[model samples]
Target: MTLNVLFAARPERWESYEPILKSEFARQGLDVALSTDHPPETVDYIIYAPNGPVQDFTAYTRCKAVMNLWAGVEQIVGNETLTQPLTRMVEEGLTGGMAEWVTGHTLRYHLEMDLDLARKPGDWSQHNPPLARDRPVTILGLGQLGQAAGQMLAGIGFPVTGWSRTQKDIEGITCLSGDEGLIEALKTAQVLVLLLPDTPATTNIINPESLALLPKGAVILNPGRGPLIDDDALLAALDLGQVAHATLDVFRTEPLPEDHPYWHHPKVTVTPHIAAETRPATAARVVAENIRRGEAGEPFLYLVDRDQGY
Candidate 1:
Protein backbone atom coordinates (compact mmCIF):
# COMPACT_ATOMS: atom_id res chain seq x y z
CA MET A 1 0.00 0.00 0.00
CA THR A 2 1.14 3.51 -0.81
CA LEU A 3 1.21 6.01 2.05
CA ASN A 4 0.26 9.63 1.52
CA VAL A 5 2.86 11.63 3.46
CA LEU A 6 2.36 15.38 3.79
CA PHE A 7 5.32 17.71 4.17
CA ALA A 8 3.94 20.53 6.31
CA ALA A 9 6.90 22.82 6.87
CA ARG A 10 7.57 26.13 5.10
CA PRO A 11 7.51 26.22 1.29
CA GLU A 12 11.29 26.56 1.12
CA ARG A 13 11.85 23.43 3.24
CA TRP A 14 9.92 21.32 0.70
CA GLU A 15 12.69 21.89 -1.82
CA SER A 16 15.39 20.83 0.63
CA TYR A 17 13.62 17.79 2.12
CA GLU A 18 11.79 16.40 -0.94
CA PRO A 19 14.65 14.49 -2.56
CA ILE A 20 16.06 13.37 0.76
CA LEU A 21 12.74 12.00 2.03
CA LYS A 22 12.12 10.34 -1.36
CA SER A 23 15.54 8.71 -1.29
CA GLU A 24 14.99 7.45 2.24
CA PHE A 25 11.55 6.06 1.46
CA ALA A 26 12.93 4.27 -1.60
CA ARG A 27 15.77 2.82 0.48
CA GLN A 28 13.23 1.55 3.01
CA GLY A 29 11.39 -0.10 0.13
CA LEU A 30 8.19 1.74 0.92
CA ASP A 31 5.82 3.20 -1.65
CA VAL A 32 5.14 6.72 -0.36
CA ALA A 33 3.30 9.58 -2.06
CA LEU A 34 5.16 12.44 -0.40
CA SER A 35 4.31 16.05 -1.23
CA THR A 36 3.50 19.43 0.29
CA ASP A 37 0.05 19.68 -1.28
CA HIS A 38 -1.59 16.38 -0.49
CA PRO A 39 -5.27 16.44 0.43
CA PRO A 40 -5.51 16.65 4.22
CA GLU A 41 -7.98 13.78 4.58
CA THR A 42 -5.79 11.45 2.55
CA VAL A 43 -2.57 12.13 4.43
CA ASP A 44 -1.56 8.93 6.24
CA TYR A 45 1.36 10.71 7.91
CA ILE A 46 2.73 14.24 8.27
CA ILE A 47 6.35 15.35 8.31
CA TYR A 48 5.97 18.42 10.50
CA ALA A 49 7.82 21.49 11.73
CA PRO A 50 6.25 23.95 14.17
CA ASN A 51 6.79 26.83 11.76
CA GLY A 52 4.69 25.02 9.17
CA PRO A 53 1.39 26.12 7.68
CA VAL A 54 -0.59 23.21 9.07
CA GLN A 55 -1.88 24.44 12.43
CA ASP A 56 -5.26 22.70 12.46
CA PHE A 57 -4.82 18.94 12.56
CA THR A 58 -8.59 18.49 12.55
CA ALA A 59 -8.52 18.47 8.77
CA TYR A 60 -6.11 15.57 8.73
CA THR A 61 -8.63 12.92 9.74
CA ARG A 62 -6.50 10.04 8.49
CA CYS A 63 -3.05 11.19 9.67
CA LYS A 64 -1.85 8.36 11.92
CA ALA A 65 1.07 10.28 13.32
CA VAL A 66 2.72 13.69 13.26
CA MET A 67 6.47 13.24 12.80
CA ASN A 68 8.29 16.37 13.88
CA LEU A 69 11.30 17.34 11.78
CA TRP A 70 12.99 19.02 14.74
CA ALA A 71 13.96 17.66 18.14
CA GLY A 72 11.80 20.12 20.04
CA VAL A 73 8.03 19.66 20.12
CA GLU A 74 7.20 22.43 22.61
CA GLN A 75 5.72 24.66 19.90
CA ILE A 76 3.16 22.11 18.74
CA VAL A 77 2.75 19.69 21.65
CA GLY A 78 -0.26 21.46 23.14
CA ASN A 79 -2.33 21.85 19.98
CA GLU A 80 -5.77 20.52 20.93
CA THR A 81 -6.45 19.56 17.34
CA LEU A 82 -3.34 17.42 17.22
CA THR A 83 -4.75 14.27 18.82
CA GLN A 84 -2.69 11.90 16.72
CA PRO A 85 0.48 10.21 18.03
CA LEU A 86 3.31 12.74 17.96
CA THR A 87 6.98 11.80 17.68
CA ARG A 88 9.96 14.13 17.99
CA MET A 89 13.13 13.75 15.93
CA VAL A 90 15.82 11.57 17.57
CA GLU A 91 18.59 11.09 15.03
CA GLU A 92 22.30 10.29 15.46
CA GLY A 93 23.47 13.53 13.85
CA LEU A 94 21.71 15.72 16.39
CA THR A 95 23.00 13.60 19.28
CA GLY A 96 26.57 13.70 17.94
CA GLY A 97 26.44 17.44 17.33
CA MET A 98 25.16 18.14 20.84
CA ALA A 99 27.80 15.89 22.36
CA GLU A 100 30.57 17.73 20.52
CA TRP A 101 29.29 21.18 21.53
CA VAL A 102 28.82 20.18 25.18
CA THR A 103 32.22 18.47 25.37
CA GLY A 104 33.99 21.43 23.76
CA HIS A 105 32.42 23.92 26.17
CA THR A 106 32.91 21.65 29.19
CA LEU A 107 36.62 21.31 28.36
CA ARG A 108 36.89 25.07 27.83
CA TYR A 109 35.57 25.65 31.33
CA HIS A 110 37.63 22.83 32.84
CA LEU A 111 40.82 24.31 31.35
CA GLU A 112 39.92 27.96 32.11
CA MET A 113 40.67 28.68 28.45
CA ASP A 114 39.30 32.25 28.56
CA LEU A 115 41.77 33.33 31.23
CA ASP A 116 44.75 32.43 29.02
CA LEU A 117 43.15 33.87 25.86
CA ALA A 118 42.46 37.24 27.50
CA ARG A 119 45.97 37.78 28.98
CA LYS A 120 47.90 40.90 28.11
CA PRO A 121 50.21 40.72 25.09
CA GLY A 122 53.44 41.19 27.09
CA ASP A 123 52.33 40.08 30.55
CA TRP A 124 53.19 36.44 31.27
CA SER A 125 50.54 35.48 33.81
CA GLN A 126 51.07 31.89 34.90
CA HIS A 127 47.91 29.97 35.59
CA ASN A 128 47.35 26.28 36.28
CA PRO A 129 44.16 24.29 35.42
CA PRO A 130 42.93 21.15 37.15
CA LEU A 131 42.41 17.74 35.57
CA ALA A 132 38.90 16.65 34.51
CA ARG A 133 38.49 14.37 37.53
CA ASP A 134 38.97 17.30 39.88
CA ARG A 135 36.17 19.24 38.15
CA PRO A 136 32.60 18.20 38.93
CA VAL A 137 30.39 18.71 35.88
CA THR A 138 26.59 18.52 36.12
CA ILE A 139 24.03 18.17 33.34
CA LEU A 140 20.43 19.31 33.95
CA GLY A 141 18.73 16.81 31.67
CA LEU A 142 19.27 13.05 31.32
CA GLY A 143 17.55 12.50 27.97
CA GLN A 144 19.16 11.24 24.78
CA LEU A 145 21.16 14.42 24.14
CA GLY A 146 22.10 14.83 27.77
CA GLN A 147 23.07 11.17 28.21
CA ALA A 148 25.25 11.28 25.09
CA ALA A 149 27.04 14.41 26.33
CA GLY A 150 27.36 12.96 29.84
CA GLN A 151 28.89 9.74 28.53
CA MET A 152 31.40 11.66 26.39
CA LEU A 153 32.41 13.87 29.31
CA ALA A 154 32.68 10.88 31.64
CA GLY A 155 34.79 9.02 29.09
CA ILE A 156 37.23 11.94 29.16
CA GLY A 157 37.66 11.60 32.96
CA PHE A 158 35.26 14.34 34.09
CA PRO A 159 33.21 13.39 37.13
CA VAL A 160 29.81 13.74 35.45
CA THR A 161 26.49 14.04 37.28
CA GLY A 162 23.15 13.98 35.50
CA TRP A 163 19.85 15.27 36.89
CA SER A 164 16.35 14.74 35.59
CA ARG A 165 12.72 15.12 36.62
CA THR A 166 12.75 11.38 37.24
CA GLN A 167 15.51 8.97 38.21
CA LYS A 168 17.79 7.42 35.60
CA ASP A 169 20.45 4.70 35.79
CA ILE A 170 23.10 5.34 33.16
CA GLU A 171 26.44 3.69 33.90
CA GLY A 172 29.60 5.77 34.42
CA ILE A 173 27.59 8.84 35.47
CA THR A 174 26.00 9.81 38.79
CA CYS A 175 22.27 10.32 38.13
CA LEU A 176 19.99 12.30 40.40
CA SER A 177 16.36 13.35 40.41
CA GLY A 178 13.65 15.21 42.42
CA ASP A 179 14.01 18.23 44.71
CA GLU A 180 16.65 16.88 47.09
CA GLY A 181 18.65 15.42 44.24
CA LEU A 182 18.57 18.81 42.52
CA ILE A 183 20.25 20.45 45.50
CA GLU A 184 22.87 17.71 45.72
CA ALA A 185 23.55 17.97 42.00
CA LEU A 186 23.91 21.76 42.14
CA LYS A 187 26.18 21.80 45.19
CA THR A 188 29.02 20.12 43.30
CA ALA A 189 28.47 21.67 39.88
CA GLN A 190 31.73 23.53 39.30
CA VAL A 191 30.64 23.45 35.66
CA LEU A 192 26.98 23.08 34.74
CA VAL A 193 25.34 22.32 31.40
CA LEU A 194 21.62 22.81 30.76
CA LEU A 195 20.05 20.41 28.25
CA LEU A 196 16.51 20.30 29.61
CA PRO A 197 13.50 20.93 27.42
CA ASP A 198 11.29 24.03 27.55
CA THR A 199 8.30 23.49 29.76
CA PRO A 200 6.45 25.22 32.59
CA ALA A 201 8.50 23.42 35.23
CA THR A 202 11.77 24.17 33.43
CA THR A 203 11.20 27.87 32.78
CA ASN A 204 13.48 29.96 34.97
CA ILE A 205 14.73 26.74 36.59
CA ILE A 206 18.08 28.39 37.18
CA ASN A 207 16.60 31.11 39.36
CA PRO A 208 18.30 32.85 42.28
CA GLU A 209 17.40 30.16 44.81
CA SER A 210 18.71 27.36 42.58
CA LEU A 211 21.75 29.40 41.49
CA ALA A 212 22.73 29.81 45.13
CA LEU A 213 23.25 26.06 45.46
CA LEU A 214 26.17 25.97 43.03
CA PRO A 215 29.74 26.25 44.27
CA LYS A 216 31.02 29.81 44.10
CA GLY A 217 32.22 30.93 40.68
CA ALA A 218 30.51 28.06 38.92
CA VAL A 219 30.49 28.15 35.14
CA ILE A 220 27.19 27.61 33.26
CA LEU A 221 26.61 26.38 29.73
CA ASN A 222 23.09 26.45 28.34
CA PRO A 223 22.54 24.87 24.92
CA GLY A 224 19.00 24.11 26.00
CA ARG A 225 15.96 26.44 26.10
CA GLY A 226 16.49 30.14 26.79
CA PRO A 227 14.08 30.44 29.69
CA LEU A 228 15.95 27.63 31.41
CA ILE A 229 18.02 30.33 33.09
CA ASP A 230 16.53 33.44 34.58
CA ASP A 231 18.34 36.32 32.89
CA ASP A 232 18.22 38.66 35.89
CA ALA A 233 19.23 35.89 38.28
CA LEU A 234 22.18 34.84 36.13
CA LEU A 235 23.25 38.45 35.78
CA ALA A 236 23.11 38.92 39.54
CA ALA A 237 25.05 35.71 40.03
CA LEU A 238 27.78 36.86 37.65
CA ASP A 239 28.00 40.26 39.34
CA LEU A 240 28.36 38.69 42.81
CA GLY A 241 31.02 36.23 41.58
CA GLN A 242 28.62 33.37 42.23
CA VAL A 243 28.79 32.32 38.59
CA ALA A 244 32.07 32.86 36.76
CA HIS A 245 30.64 32.80 33.20
CA ALA A 246 27.67 31.66 31.18
CA THR A 247 27.47 30.44 27.56
CA LEU A 248 23.89 30.71 26.34
CA ASP A 249 22.61 29.60 22.94
CA VAL A 250 18.79 29.35 22.97
CA PHE A 251 16.71 32.30 24.16
CA ARG A 252 13.13 33.33 24.88
CA THR A 253 13.37 35.56 21.84
CA GLU A 254 15.14 34.66 18.64
CA PRO A 255 17.86 36.98 17.24
CA LEU A 256 18.27 37.90 20.96
CA PRO A 257 17.21 41.54 21.10
CA GLU A 258 20.00 44.10 20.64
CA ASP A 259 19.48 45.54 24.12
CA HIS A 260 19.43 42.18 25.90
CA PRO A 261 21.82 42.23 28.87
CA TYR A 262 23.23 38.81 27.93
CA TRP A 263 24.62 40.41 24.74
CA HIS A 264 26.52 43.02 26.74
CA HIS A 265 27.41 41.06 29.88
CA PRO A 266 31.19 40.78 30.16
CA LYS A 267 31.17 37.28 31.61
CA VAL A 268 28.41 35.93 29.41
CA THR A 269 28.82 34.40 25.94
CA VAL A 270 25.81 34.63 23.64
CA THR A 271 25.77 32.12 20.79
CA PRO A 272 22.94 32.67 18.31
CA HIS A 273 20.99 29.44 18.91
CA ILE A 274 23.48 27.45 16.82
CA ALA A 275 24.36 24.70 19.28
CA ALA A 276 22.82 22.09 16.97
CA GLU A 277 20.43 21.89 14.04
CA THR A 278 18.56 19.06 12.31
CA ARG A 279 20.47 17.67 9.35
CA PRO A 280 18.22 16.50 6.52
CA ALA A 281 20.34 13.49 5.56
CA THR A 282 20.30 11.69 8.92
CA ALA A 283 16.92 13.04 10.03
CA ALA A 284 15.27 11.66 6.91
CA ARG A 285 16.31 8.15 7.81
CA VAL A 286 14.84 8.52 11.30
CA VAL A 287 11.54 9.75 9.89
CA ALA A 288 11.48 6.87 7.42
CA GLU A 289 12.17 4.38 10.18
CA ASN A 290 9.34 5.67 12.32
CA ILE A 291 6.94 5.56 9.38
CA ARG A 292 8.04 2.02 8.68
CA ARG A 293 7.40 1.13 12.33
CA GLY A 294 3.90 2.60 12.20
CA GLU A 295 3.17 0.45 9.17
CA ALA A 296 4.58 -2.71 10.74
CA GLY A 297 2.65 -2.41 14.05
CA GLU A 298 5.86 -1.72 15.98
CA PRO A 299 6.21 1.05 18.56
CA PHE A 300 7.31 4.52 17.41
CA LEU A 301 10.60 5.86 18.65
CA TYR A 302 10.79 9.10 20.69
CA LEU A 303 7.06 9.47 21.09
CA VAL A 304 6.28 12.56 23.15
CA ASP A 305 4.39 12.25 26.43
CA ARG A 306 1.53 14.71 26.43
CA ASP A 307 1.38 14.93 30.22
CA GLN A 308 5.11 15.41 30.68
CA GLY A 309 5.26 17.91 27.80
CA TYR A 310 8.69 16.72 26.51
Candidate 2:
Protein backbone atom coordinates (compact mmCIF):
# COMPACT_ATOMS: atom_id res chain seq x y z
CA MET A 1 0.00 0.00 0.00
CA THR A 2 1.28 3.45 -0.93
CA LEU A 3 1.51 5.89 1.99
CA ASN A 4 0.14 9.37 1.43
CA VAL A 5 2.39 12.06 2.95
CA LEU A 6 1.32 15.67 3.16
CA PHE A 7 3.83 18.49 2.80
CA ALA A 8 2.00 20.94 5.00
CA ALA A 9 4.30 23.94 5.41
CA ARG A 10 4.55 27.33 3.75
CA PRO A 11 4.39 27.54 -0.07
CA GLU A 12 8.02 28.60 -0.39
CA ARG A 13 9.10 25.66 1.76
CA TRP A 14 7.37 23.33 -0.71
CA GLU A 15 9.70 24.53 -3.48
CA SER A 16 12.78 23.63 -1.44
CA TYR A 17 11.51 20.45 0.23
CA GLU A 18 9.56 18.70 -2.55
CA PRO A 19 12.44 17.31 -4.62
CA ILE A 20 14.55 16.47 -1.56
CA LEU A 21 11.69 14.63 0.12
CA LYS A 22 10.88 12.71 -3.05
CA SER A 23 14.51 11.65 -3.41
CA GLU A 24 14.69 10.72 0.27
CA PHE A 25 11.51 8.63 0.08
CA ALA A 26 12.98 6.69 -2.86
CA ARG A 27 16.20 6.18 -0.96
CA GLN A 28 14.24 4.90 2.01
CA GLY A 29 12.57 2.31 -0.29
CA LEU A 30 9.11 3.59 0.47
CA ASP A 31 6.27 3.97 -2.05
CA VAL A 32 4.87 7.33 -1.05
CA ALA A 33 2.51 9.77 -2.74
CA LEU A 34 3.77 13.16 -1.55
CA SER A 35 1.77 16.34 -2.14
CA THR A 36 0.83 19.72 -0.61
CA ASP A 37 -2.89 19.14 -1.09
CA HIS A 38 -3.51 15.52 -0.11
CA PRO A 39 -6.92 14.99 1.50
CA PRO A 40 -6.31 15.19 5.28
CA GLU A 41 -7.99 11.82 5.88
CA THR A 42 -5.72 10.20 3.30
CA VAL A 43 -2.48 11.47 4.83
CA ASP A 44 -0.53 8.69 6.49
CA TYR A 45 1.95 11.24 7.84
CA ILE A 46 2.41 14.98 7.86
CA ILE A 47 5.69 16.84 7.44
CA TYR A 48 4.66 19.86 9.43
CA ALA A 49 5.68 23.41 10.41
CA PRO A 50 3.67 25.41 12.93
CA ASN A 51 3.43 28.35 10.55
CA GLY A 52 1.98 26.02 7.93
CA PRO A 53 -1.65 25.89 6.77
CA VAL A 54 -2.61 22.56 8.36
CA GLN A 55 -3.65 23.91 11.75
CA ASP A 56 -6.74 21.77 12.13
CA PHE A 57 -5.65 18.20 12.77
CA THR A 58 -9.15 16.89 13.46
CA ALA A 59 -9.54 15.92 9.83
CA TYR A 60 -6.23 14.10 9.66
CA THR A 61 -7.73 10.89 11.06
CA ARG A 62 -5.17 8.61 9.39
CA CYS A 63 -2.00 10.57 10.14
CA LYS A 64 0.29 8.09 11.85
CA ALA A 65 2.58 10.86 13.08
CA VAL A 66 3.38 14.51 12.63
CA MET A 67 7.05 15.00 11.74
CA ASN A 68 8.05 18.49 12.77
CA LEU A 69 10.65 20.18 10.59
CA TRP A 70 11.78 22.51 13.38
CA ALA A 71 13.53 21.67 16.62
CA GLY A 72 11.32 23.74 18.92
CA VAL A 73 7.69 22.59 19.27
CA GLU A 74 6.34 25.24 21.66
CA GLN A 75 4.20 26.69 18.90
CA ILE A 76 2.22 23.57 18.07
CA VAL A 77 2.37 21.41 21.19
CA GLY A 78 -0.63 23.02 22.84
CA ASN A 79 -3.08 22.53 19.96
CA GLU A 80 -5.96 20.48 21.44
CA THR A 81 -6.84 19.05 18.06
CA LEU A 82 -3.42 17.47 17.43
CA THR A 83 -3.76 13.93 18.81
CA GLN A 84 -1.26 12.10 16.60
CA PRO A 85 2.16 11.04 17.85
CA LEU A 86 4.50 13.95 17.18
CA THR A 87 8.26 13.93 16.73
CA ARG A 88 10.54 16.94 16.95
CA MET A 89 13.51 17.32 14.59
CA VAL A 90 16.90 16.42 16.14
CA GLU A 91 19.16 15.85 13.15
CA GLU A 92 22.89 16.53 12.81
CA GLY A 93 22.55 19.70 10.77
CA LEU A 94 20.45 21.46 13.40
CA THR A 95 22.57 20.19 16.27
CA GLY A 96 25.89 21.04 14.57
CA GLY A 97 24.69 24.48 13.61
CA MET A 98 23.59 25.19 17.17
CA ALA A 99 26.85 23.89 18.62
CA GLU A 100 28.89 26.06 16.29
CA TRP A 101 26.89 29.20 16.99
CA VAL A 102 26.96 28.66 20.74
CA THR A 103 30.71 28.01 20.74
CA GLY A 104 31.44 31.07 18.64
CA HIS A 105 29.55 33.39 20.96
CA THR A 106 31.05 31.72 24.01
CA LEU A 107 34.57 32.26 22.72
CA ARG A 108 33.74 35.85 21.93
CA TYR A 109 32.85 36.45 25.59
CA HIS A 110 35.79 34.42 26.91
CA LEU A 111 38.22 36.57 24.92
CA GLU A 112 36.40 39.90 25.36
CA MET A 113 36.53 40.33 21.58
CA ASP A 114 33.98 43.13 21.49
CA LEU A 115 36.23 45.60 23.37
CA ASP A 116 38.98 45.20 20.79
CA LEU A 117 36.54 45.29 17.89
CA ALA A 118 35.23 48.66 19.06
CA ARG A 119 38.62 50.17 19.87
CA LYS A 120 39.47 53.45 18.16
CA PRO A 121 42.33 53.38 15.64
CA GLY A 122 44.80 55.00 18.10
CA ASP A 123 43.48 53.55 21.35
CA TRP A 124 45.84 50.67 22.02
CA SER A 125 45.12 49.04 25.34
CA GLN A 126 46.43 45.60 26.16
CA HIS A 127 44.06 43.00 27.66
CA ASN A 128 45.05 39.43 28.41
CA PRO A 129 42.30 36.77 28.27
CA PRO A 130 42.40 33.70 30.51
CA LEU A 131 42.86 30.30 28.96
CA ALA A 132 39.71 28.24 28.20
CA ARG A 133 40.59 25.98 31.14
CA ASP A 134 40.01 28.83 33.57
CA ARG A 135 36.60 29.76 32.18
CA PRO A 136 33.59 28.12 33.80
CA VAL A 137 30.61 27.87 31.44
CA THR A 138 27.10 26.80 32.42
CA ILE A 139 24.50 25.57 29.97
CA LEU A 140 20.84 25.36 30.88
CA GLY A 141 18.79 22.51 29.38
CA LEU A 142 20.58 19.21 28.79
CA GLY A 143 18.63 18.14 25.74
CA GLN A 144 20.31 17.33 22.40
CA LEU A 145 21.31 20.89 21.55
CA GLY A 146 22.52 21.63 25.08
CA GLN A 147 24.54 18.41 25.26
CA ALA A 148 26.17 19.09 21.90
CA ALA A 149 27.12 22.66 22.83
CA GLY A 150 28.36 21.65 26.27
CA GLN A 151 30.48 18.84 24.85
CA MET A 152 32.05 21.17 22.30
CA LEU A 153 32.88 23.68 25.02
CA ALA A 154 34.25 20.97 27.29
CA GLY A 155 36.37 19.57 24.47
CA ILE A 156 37.92 23.02 24.09
CA GLY A 157 39.04 23.01 27.76
CA PHE A 158 36.22 25.02 29.32
CA PRO A 159 34.86 23.60 32.55
CA VAL A 160 31.28 22.92 31.45
CA THR A 161 28.33 22.67 33.83
CA GLY A 162 24.87 21.64 32.64
CA TRP A 163 21.56 22.09 34.43
CA SER A 164 18.28 20.51 33.47
CA ARG A 165 14.87 19.83 34.98
CA THR A 166 16.03 16.28 35.66
CA GLN A 167 19.52 15.13 36.53
CA LYS A 168 21.67 14.12 33.57
CA ASP A 169 24.93 12.16 33.48
CA ILE A 170 26.85 13.36 30.44
CA GLU A 171 30.57 12.58 30.58
CA GLY A 172 32.93 15.56 31.13
CA ILE A 173 30.06 17.89 32.13
CA THR A 174 29.31 18.68 35.74
CA CYS A 175 25.61 17.90 35.63
CA LEU A 176 23.17 19.52 38.08
CA SER A 177 19.42 19.50 38.40
CA GLY A 178 16.50 20.85 40.50
CA ASP A 179 16.39 24.18 42.38
CA GLU A 180 19.49 23.78 44.55
CA GLY A 181 21.51 22.59 41.58
CA LEU A 182 20.37 25.59 39.59
CA ILE A 183 21.88 27.84 42.25
CA GLU A 184 25.18 25.98 42.08
CA ALA A 185 25.20 26.13 38.28
CA LEU A 186 24.65 29.88 38.24
CA LYS A 187 27.18 30.73 40.97
CA THR A 188 30.29 29.96 38.95
CA ALA A 189 28.96 30.60 35.46
CA GLN A 190 31.28 33.22 33.98
CA VAL A 191 29.48 32.63 30.71
CA LEU A 192 25.92 31.32 31.03
CA VAL A 193 24.15 29.90 28.00
CA LEU A 194 20.42 29.35 27.90
CA LEU A 195 19.16 26.48 25.69
CA LEU A 196 16.10 25.49 27.71
CA PRO A 197 12.67 25.04 26.11
CA ASP A 198 9.72 27.38 26.66
CA THR A 199 7.69 25.63 29.32
CA PRO A 200 5.82 26.97 32.35
CA ALA A 201 8.65 25.91 34.63
CA THR A 202 11.27 27.53 32.41
CA THR A 203 9.53 30.75 31.51
CA ASN A 204 11.44 33.65 33.06
CA ILE A 205 13.90 31.19 34.54
CA ILE A 206 16.42 34.03 34.23
CA ASN A 207 14.71 36.60 36.39
CA PRO A 208 16.42 38.99 38.85
CA GLU A 209 16.71 36.32 41.56
CA SER A 210 18.45 33.90 39.23
CA LEU A 211 20.48 36.68 37.64
CA ALA A 212 21.74 37.67 41.09
CA LEU A 213 23.26 34.23 41.55
CA LEU A 214 25.76 34.57 38.70
CA PRO A 215 29.37 35.61 39.29
CA LYS A 216 29.37 39.37 38.92
CA GLY A 217 30.02 40.59 35.37
CA ALA A 218 29.11 37.26 33.87
CA VAL A 219 28.23 37.16 30.18
CA ILE A 220 24.89 35.67 29.12
CA LEU A 221 24.10 34.11 25.76
CA ASN A 222 20.51 33.26 24.94
CA PRO A 223 20.08 31.29 21.74
CA GLY A 224 17.10 29.49 23.17
CA ARG A 225 13.57 30.76 23.69
CA GLY A 226 12.93 34.45 24.43
CA PRO A 227 10.51 33.81 27.25
CA LEU A 228 13.23 32.03 29.20
CA ILE A 229 14.55 35.37 30.36
CA ASP A 230 12.66 38.23 31.91
CA ASP A 231 13.34 41.32 29.78
CA ASP A 232 12.91 43.81 32.59
CA ALA A 233 15.11 41.82 34.94
CA LEU A 234 17.83 41.40 32.33
CA LEU A 235 17.80 45.09 31.49
CA ALA A 236 18.06 45.90 35.17
CA ALA A 237 20.86 43.45 35.61
CA LEU A 238 22.74 45.06 32.72
CA ASP A 239 22.37 48.54 34.19
CA LEU A 240 23.76 47.47 37.57
CA GLY A 241 26.66 45.51 35.99
CA GLN A 242 25.23 42.28 37.45
CA VAL A 243 25.67 41.03 33.90
CA ALA A 244 28.46 42.51 31.79
CA HIS A 245 26.91 41.77 28.42
CA ALA A 246 24.20 39.70 26.76
CA THR A 247 24.03 38.28 23.26
CA LEU A 248 20.43 37.44 22.47
CA ASP A 249 19.40 35.60 19.28
CA VAL A 250 15.79 34.82 20.09
CA PHE A 251 13.03 37.05 21.40
CA ARG A 252 9.39 36.86 22.46
CA THR A 253 8.55 38.98 19.44
CA GLU A 254 10.53 38.11 16.35
CA PRO A 255 11.97 40.99 14.35
CA LEU A 256 12.09 42.52 17.82
CA PRO A 257 10.27 45.81 17.72
CA GLU A 258 12.38 48.78 16.60
CA ASP A 259 11.50 50.63 19.77
CA HIS A 260 12.48 47.81 22.09
CA PRO A 261 15.04 48.84 24.73
CA TYR A 262 17.40 46.03 23.74
CA TRP A 263 17.96 47.80 20.41
CA HIS A 264 19.57 50.76 22.17
CA HIS A 265 21.18 49.01 25.12
CA PRO A 266 24.96 49.28 25.01
CA LYS A 267 25.46 45.91 26.69
CA VAL A 268 23.10 43.94 24.48
CA THR A 269 23.79 42.31 21.12
CA VAL A 270 20.64 41.14 19.40
CA THR A 271 20.89 38.90 16.38
CA PRO A 272 17.80 38.05 14.44
CA HIS A 273 16.90 34.44 15.28
CA ILE A 274 19.57 32.66 13.20
CA ALA A 275 21.20 30.49 15.86
CA ALA A 276 20.01 27.12 14.52
CA GLU A 277 17.82 26.31 11.54
CA THR A 278 16.55 23.02 10.16
CA ARG A 279 18.56 22.24 7.06
CA PRO A 280 16.44 20.66 4.36
CA ALA A 281 19.12 18.22 3.17
CA THR A 282 19.65 16.61 6.59
CA ALA A 283 16.15 17.21 7.97
CA ALA A 284 14.48 15.32 5.12
CA ARG A 285 16.37 12.15 6.03
CA VAL A 286 15.08 12.39 9.63
CA VAL A 287 11.51 12.81 8.43
CA ALA A 288 11.95 9.92 6.00
CA GLU A 289 13.46 7.72 8.68
CA ASN A 290 10.57 8.40 11.05
CA ILE A 291 8.05 7.56 8.34
CA ARG A 292 10.02 4.39 7.73
CA ARG A 293 9.86 3.62 11.45
CA GLY A 294 6.11 4.21 11.48
CA GLU A 295 5.68 1.73 8.62
CA ALA A 296 7.98 -0.83 10.30
CA GLY A 297 6.13 -0.60 13.65
CA GLU A 298 9.34 0.52 15.37
CA PRO A 299 9.15 3.26 17.96
CA PHE A 300 9.72 6.68 16.39
CA LEU A 301 12.79 8.71 17.45
CA TYR A 302 12.67 12.10 19.23
CA LEU A 303 9.06 11.63 20.23
CA VAL A 304 7.80 14.70 22.11
CA ASP A 305 6.40 14.15 25.60
CA ARG A 306 3.18 16.11 25.34
CA ASP A 307 2.81 16.53 29.09
CA GLN A 308 6.37 17.78 29.68
CA GLY A 309 5.79 20.09 26.70
CA TYR A 310 9.16 19.76 25.01
Most accurate candidate by TM-score: 2
What TM-score do all the candidates reach, one by one?
Answer: 0.97, 0.99
CA shift of 251, model 1, Å: 0.9
lDDT of 1: 0.93
- Model 2 clash pairs are none
lDDT of 2 by residue, 132-169 (tens): 99999999999999999999999999999999999999
- The TM-score measured for candidate 2 stands at 0.99
